[model samples]
Target: MAPTVLRLLLMLLALLPTIGLGNNAAIADTDSTPAELTIANRSIFTFHATFLGETPAARAQRATAVIEEALRGTDELKVSIDPLQNSYLVLLGNRRAFIVSPQDLEVSGGDTRVAAEQAAAVLRQVVDESGEARNLHFLLKAFGLSALATLIFLVLIKGAHLARRKLRGRLPQLMRERARQIRVGQMPLFDMQFVYRIIDRLLSLFYWVVVLLLGYQWLSFVLSQFPYTRPWGESLNVHLLDLLRYLLDGILQAIPGIAVAILIFFIARGISGFSRRVLERMARPGTLNWLTEETLQPTVRLTSLAIWLFALVMAYPYLPGSGTDAFKGLSVLLGLMISLGASSMVGQAAAGLILTYSRTLKTGEYVRVGDNEGTVTEVGMFNTTIRTGLGEVLTLPNSMITGSVTRNYSRAVQGRGYIVDTVVTIGYDTPWRQVEAMLVAAAQRTEGILDTPKPQVFQTGLSDFYPEYRLVAQAVPSEPRPRAELLSLLHANIQDVFNEYGVQIMSPHYLGDPAQEKWVPQDKWYTAPAKGQSADEP
Candidate 1:
């Protein structure tokens, strides 16, 4: 047993030289040739030898001797017996030459001079059988190892795919159950459905990535044993990993901005809802109108704007161009543009603010500006709109309104009565006392005139043709449309009263001469009472 082991070890040692020689010869051939060389002039040489030898090495030695014998008459196939060459040469069919190195054979271009001679020698030595046996063994071993590796890779990929499918199938049902529970009780931290979907998608992505990575590693391992694909596989691995790294970086960068945007949207919605409720409550009957007008809407708008601005600032780093020089330059340019164009807008806004705080006129208030009298319908930052009784709407800039004189009739008297006055003309023949009584009675007879304040009559002017009397009446505060009606009624009543008193109203006549006497009704009716009666008997 000891001798058998020692002999086996010696045989392995003896084969080491042939392996070394084959490796060196392969390297030398590859180094000596360019990579672009085609297989155009290739040749194959087979050798079969009937060796009457006792050992395998001796048989191989006899095969080498047969190959050398075939090369003797061939000029192109030179058989060098040098120990360093560790090979023999032969000519093949006169088309090519072969160098049978220690463990491999090389073929090259040669002339067709020694073809018949080499063929005869090969036939005599019988070289084909030994070479065919060696080639068949090598090809069968390579094919078996390749088939085993492919089978293992396919089984691994198939198992991983099956596992992934099973997990994916179970995920949806579990997520549905969890979502139902959350909906029935309270809201979860993240929306249950959304979170579950995100998790499932991430898991799916991870599973595919792991599968792909494992496949790639296995392929790289298998390819490393190959002579052609080893270098290319390493480069592909680096590019694949770089792509995955860039994808991860992009996802990470987007997460914070997406979160911030969602948060801001929800928060703004909540705040807007709260503010609306508060405004509705405040706008209810009997609440302070000033609070609704001055505080609620502007506060809500400003708060919403501020929240969005803050969110934008917080998300700036995650914005695509926020950190770039172009963004900074654009910011500056936009600011300059706004400054150039916003001066009038700023002025109008300031004026509007002043108008709101001043409370000079509100919507639905009757106002008169110069000759324009109307009801205010809208008040904007830049303009105030009014609808006139004549059915015309007028838009006035805030700046124009601020510098003009405006009379607000609604604010003149809160709950007090409004005064409506009318004027009349009568001859001097009418007694001043009687005129005063007649004017007061006329105002009292008019509809919508307040009797408590008592209509007043003042002698406004005493012209040469007539004496002008002003009749003023008070109206109820709630009666807005009664002023013109009351005035018309009073003038009609005055005409009737003056006619009853026989007082001539001198409206059309101007005094042409003082000598033309205006008639006195009392002078015409002057007759002395009958004598011999009691003195007070008129």
Candidate 2:
């Protein structure tokens, strides 16, 4: 393995549980100290002995000094197990000794006397192991063992890789066949290749995991070979355990909130579904007289959105990290952006709502707004679409529509057939009654004119050269004829009727009357393309 990878493995191994030597690995010279003391980087104990009113820390220092002195001198070090006292003493020559307390050996899983013997044994081993000669020997032994462990780790990794390569070549066909067996409505629920690819990835992950574990075990074992690195191995194990415990604790703490959020989501979804169904029923005719089927879906959708939003808001506090400043800041920023950018949208939406509730404009209604007149095809939240009389569709913003004057031809038809009117000029020499009768006769000949209301004629103005006569008549509302077609027919009928009567229809701007009178003679009325017989023929 690469050195970087090994270093990473060592770090990772630190998090594992320390397995060797158990909890009694560290020893204390006395029972009064919580602070553990170490000799040559090896944990001795959490034991502290107070002597001559000295603190445990001071006393531990003194014990360490005696041990160092014994090691320096030629005097042999001796560990005497004292069973009655439930402790062991390490003596230097005949004068100096340090007591190793029962609490120190208690971690080794033994009674006080047994612990005392264990402490004595460990002390003798430590004294012998502390010399330069033993250290060099230990260092060399550690390197050799580390090399062997590394070779074993490499072999294991190579095997795992070889196994993985073999599986990769063979597993795809097997995974694909398994995936093909699952189907829905004769369609494959999952792609065979996709399942195979996922299986391959999982296998690769498993191989990597095995390699990492092997590297970790090798690193831990190598560190334990030398006294200087033994404590590091122990700490690595402790820290790994601590990290796992922390992760488990965090997951446990978040479980209740996560569960609550999920429950809220499901409940909100159910409520939305139920409400939509109820609204649909209410939208049917006779169920709720005020609610129209057209408005039902939009209302349901808006209501559902509101319910979901409310549910999320209520559940937000229960979500992990919801109370964090970052989440709050993000929420505030989004709200601010919407408020700033949605002014026109809000106006349009509000206008749409107004249009809906006020019944100003509805689908299928023929209406004129400003210069654009058409049949309203749809009224949406932001815009209203109308197909014009000219076959052109115009999409106008709802806010703009709300601000304009709207004339509904359909509504006018509902009350009284919409009036179709035209104005004409005649010489003042023509009798007023005759002019009125002639204009009304022109309206009566129009195909779409409603006869029951009767056509009316009025002298709208007395111009400089003529009398302005206005003819008004209601068109049949149910008639499917266009306004232009109806007006064209009316104009043709008026011209024919005037020609048969020999009364010329002049304009107010005429400078003088023509030499032979501008009216067409009855014989010449159906000239050329005008093959229809004149009004006076029958």
TM-score of each: 0.39, 0.49
Best-fitting candidate, scored by lDDT: 2
The ten-residue window of minimal lDDT in model 1 covers 34-43
Give candidate 1 regions above 4 Å deviation: 1-252, 268-320, 324-333, 414-538
Question: On residues 1-538, what C-alpha lDDT tens digit does candidate 1 reach at each position?
Answer: 6434543544454455477743332232222222211111111233221111113233344444545454444333322221123333333333113333333222343322243244335433333322332466745664576677778878887887788889878887887787766663466545766786798788889878877877786666565433334345565677778988999997888777777767766776787677667766876667966655554565556556776677666666656557789999998998999899799988988887667767777776767777776768887778889887566899988888888998775565435445667777777766888989988987777777777767789999988777888886676656654334556777877775665576666766666535544434433332466234343456
lDDT of each residue in 1-538, candidate 2, tens digit only = 3434533443333323355423332334355654554676755544544433455676567767876777777656665643223444444444334555555444554555554455456556666666543567767877898899889888988898899999988896776676668878779888777777788789988988888778777777877777656767777777778888999998998899999999999999999999999998888888876578667867887899999999999899889878889999999999999989899888999999888867787887767899987778899999999986566889999988889999876664444345577888989877989888877888888888888778888888887899898887777877756555677799888887888788988964779978877898778877787778764678
Q: What would you estimate as the lDDT of candidate 1?
A: 0.60
Report the C-alpha displacement of residue 445, candidate 1, in angstroms.
7.7
lDDT of 2 at 141: 78
Provide the overall lDDT of each model, using Cα atoms, as 2-decimal numbers.
Answer: 0.60, 0.73
